[model samples]
Target: MSAEHTASAPAGPLWRLALGRSLGRSRKFLWFLLINILPLYVASDLLVTSGALAKISGFLEPVMSLWGLPPEAAAVLLAGMLVNLYAATAVAAPLALSWQQVSVLGLILGIAHSLIMEAVVVRQLTRRYHALTLLRIVLGLGAGWLLALVLC
Candidate 1:
């Protein structure tokens, strides 16, 4: 048997401990999604229904235009940057984005998503958290811009 399997303590207790932690983490993820993402999604629907999304899109259109994205894409990018992919995806679901637009967003958000939360972990790991986070945002958007130029 392997050394790990032959530890002094039997495997059953270790397995149970791992399982318990896994379940705990899973529950936490579900709860977080429910409380955070669900409300954003409902708000998105409300914005759409109330015709407020147009105003929002118009206001953000200038920044989004940099990547050939529609103003509505600002919500997706903002959600990804401030929160996480789950929030971004929820915001994006109602938008009828083209394949090119989706690809560009996927490329950008993949690198730079979850900035505020991730910065804490980055700060823990490195002293240059500010530079690193800024670099990721620049690189992600730069790459997305190049891709959008090519695709469009």
Candidate 2:
């Protein structure tokens, strides 16, 4: 109930940002954001805004460029892979990506989101977790490539 702890709904893409924000200003969402998203955003923000990621981004640019994304998208993609799509999205909102680029990112994450956790969940259900995980990643990238080629 305190002023400092209270956060307004987030702003950005309509459905993912606005609707989710409106529906998700609850305590649990706040806790999840603080715990799961904030640190990633903080580190990504520091690296991105401070220009510290330039060198790393240089190395990643080629890979991200395949998806018609900028090097900063690597952070967004990493956040999605290591954490969850929501976290990746939260991290990505400030990057000023175009609608088409966001769409490409969405296409990739939709197929391969939350690999670290989902892979474990998949492992619990099947013995082919590694293959499935690899397939998702490869398919995700391939899908992104196709989408980027089409969109751009």
Candidate 3:
């Protein structure tokens, strides 16, 4: 009876532990990063060059001012989303943005970036929209607002 119950039970610690070990292997992690990094970089460059970056900047610039950001901050924000943190930093650094603006950008990026891919990834993981996606946007904007208030 005990053996039957054990066999029928769902996978336990051993399965989880093995999975964790496999994931922890550096080769797998490196391969995963290698697979993704190039596409993200190329797409980020194209987005910036194709004027999408300018358009997004135009939209966000006004809203960002409330957070004490400059108009050009839109570039940084969009770059961060399209590329990653490093690319955004490169764009923003040349602007020599105020401390408040930097903080705000940090807050916004923390909540969401690479949004399209992320949405798909989230859907795959949860098998349902948990509505947290909306929360991410709100939190990003609110966080920027709060950070601006605190810093400025």
Best model number under lDDT: 1
Writing each residue's lDDT as its tens digit, candidate 3 over 1-152 gives 47663344456776775666667896775765567655555665676568665676676777767888866677777777766676676566656567767778988987866665677779977855447667777788788888888888
**Candidate 1 ranges with C-alpha deviation above 4 Å:** 1-17
Error of 1 at 88 (Å): 1.2
Candidate 2 residue spans exceeding 4 A from truth: 1-26
lDDT of 1 by residue, 91-125 (tens): 88777788989999999999999998999999999
Cα lDDT of model 1 overall?
0.88
Backbone clash tally (model 2): 0
Q: List the residue pairs that clash in candidate 3.
A: none
Per-model C-alpha RMSD? 3.7, 10.5, 7.1
Model 3: CA > 4 A from native: 1-61
lDDT agreement with native, every candidate: 0.88, 0.83, 0.70
Best of the two (1, 2) by lDDT: 1
For candidate 3, give the lDDT of residue 137.
Answer: 70
TM-score of each: 0.82, 0.74, 0.56
Tell me how far candidate 2 lies from the true structure as C-alpha RMSD in angstroms: 10.5
